[model samples]
Target: MNVTGDDVRSLALSLPETTEQFAWGMPIFKVSGKLFLTLPEGETSMAVRCPILDRDELVLAEPAKFWIAAHEAGNAWVRVYLSALDDREELTAIVTDSWRQAAPRALLDSP
Candidate 1:
């Protein structure tokens, strides 16, 4: 199933304490002022928090769906091709994981 920008926005914003902000002409989602997700490349893709090692592995495992932008290569971020996502559940998982990474420790333990 293909994921749209609306899907990205909804899933990201549904996460605990997530908020949206505009930057670089794109919608970015943050957890307590820390960015966790962003709609980039005409909203066709989304960048999310992911460790460098894991990002590389994901790209290698699914080049069609995962990649690192040249400008973001130095950061712990991975780009996911929305059109190539497996389904809503996968998108939710990705957004949730990214949110968890950016959320504060207190938020993580909170109910």
Candidate 2:
């Protein structure tokens, strides 16, 4: 099964409750205006804001696209190749994690 931008959007929307918008000319999934993920038109790959340690690990594992050591957000985010995802299950988990981190507990508690 091929992953598409629609899949990305759907995954993001599936989160508890969040918002979608664009930033830096790319699609951004956020909660209360803070970006959680960003991807270009095709959504072939996505960048998730991460801590310095996690970013280091990802860059070492996949040096080609998972660039770091020099970035706009520096060590605050890392790009994840959509193709690197073993299956839709992993993709969903990762996307959900990003959303959960971005979404505040209060928002999730909202009825």
Candidate 3:
């Protein structure tokens, strides 16, 4: 299945404290000003916060679906191919995980 910008926007926005912002000619999803996801390359791909170690492993394990752009190489982030995503559930999991990483302690602990 293929995921689109709308899918990204909807899933990301459903998370707590999430908001959409346009930057660098693309859509970015943030949690209280801390960005968790960005849709670039015409929304065909997304960059999300991931642990540095997990980022490398994801890219290595599934190069077709995950990667690290050169500009973000020094950061703790990974890019995911929307087209490679299996379904909305998968996207939600990914977005939620990133959201957890960016969300504040209070938000995380909130019901």
Candidate 4:
């Protein structure tokens, strides 16, 4: 619900071993040095790690909520429209899932 880049940043940093770094002129969140999410230039949307298969299905299922930037095509990432999120729960789940994907196995094993 009206998720902003700050919402994204706070959530991402709340996860274990996550850090914020700037790359390609945007903010990127990484887990143990592995990139997990990115807040593009306008911060209207965020890109998160997603299996290519799942990304395609998501984009097709909810084009307004999810998409793959042309430059990001062929990569295992999907962009979520912050404005399109249904609620904070959805945002948390999405961000956490991306964190899980990039987090070290040791971190995943912990609570």
Candidate 5:
């Protein structure tokens, strides 16, 4: 029941200023030119940016739903398990937050 890369791409496209690109062979989503999330090629996880303090809490609460990429290991970002996200509300919150973090401050301050 793993969600495909297209599913991730579609979700990102629905966000404001989100555009897709390749970063380290992964599908990276950006908002106003800043990266927010990435689904690495041939991998089973997703790289999602989060407030530094929130990383441990999220992973501890749902280990199955979260992990950190080896490269980004121990960083603020966590790799969320796409298959574990069946709850639309929670997913929406995370995706929206990602967009907010990636979006420029001017855009956020604007309207």
Candidate 6:
């Protein structure tokens, strides 16, 4: 199944303390006021917080699915093509991972 921006939004909002806001004329998801994900203007791809160290590897390993916007090159974020996603499960994993990165420690420790 194809993963769309709506799927990304739903998965993102499902995470604890996640909220949607608009910025740069695009939808952005935040956890406890910390940005974790963003759906750029086209909604065809999403930018998610990623460890700077892992970003290069992900992009190099799967250029079709992952990439770093030139504007975000020095930041710890990577853009993921929604159309390239394999399934909802994969989307969940990706969205949740980003949420975890931005989620507060208390939220992370919660059962």
lDDT of 1 by residue, 1-111 (tens): 978999899878878888999999999999999999999999999999999999999999999999999999999999999999998889988999999999999999988
lDDT of 3 by residue, 1-111 (tens): 878989889889988889999999998999999999999999999999999999999999999999999999999999999999988889988989999999999999988
lDDT of candidates 1 onward, in order: 0.93, 0.72, 0.93, 0.94, 0.77, 0.92
TM-score of 5: 0.85
Indicate which candidate wins on TM-score.
Answer: 1
Candidates 2 and 3 compared by TM-score, better number: 3
Q: How far does residue 7 in candidate 6 sit from its true spot (Å)?
A: 0.6
TM-score of each: 0.97, 0.78, 0.97, 0.97, 0.85, 0.96
Tell me the tens digit of each residue's lDDT in model 4 across 4-110: 99999999999889999999999999999999999995899999999999999999999999999999898999999999999999999999999999889998998
What C-alpha root-mean-square deviation, in Å, does candidate 5 show against the real structure?
2.0
List where candidate 2 sits over 4 angstroms from the true fold.
Answer: 108-111
The positional error of residue 1 in candidate 1, measured at the CA in angstroms, is 0.4
* Clash number for each model: 0, 0, 0, 0, 0, 0
Best by lDDT: 4
Model 3 lDDT at residue 48: 94
RMSD of 4: 0.8
Q: Weakest 10 consecutive residues, lDDT, candidate 6?
A: 1-10
Q: Which of candidates 2 and 4 is the stronger one according to TM-score?
A: 4
> Ten-residue segment with the worst summed lDDT in candidate 2?
65-74
What C-alpha lDDT does candidate 3 achieve relative to the native structure? Answer: 0.93
- Model 2, residue 35: distance off in Å is 1.1
Q: How much does candidate 3 score in TM-score?
A: 0.97
TM-score of 6: 0.96
What are the clashing pairs of model 1? none
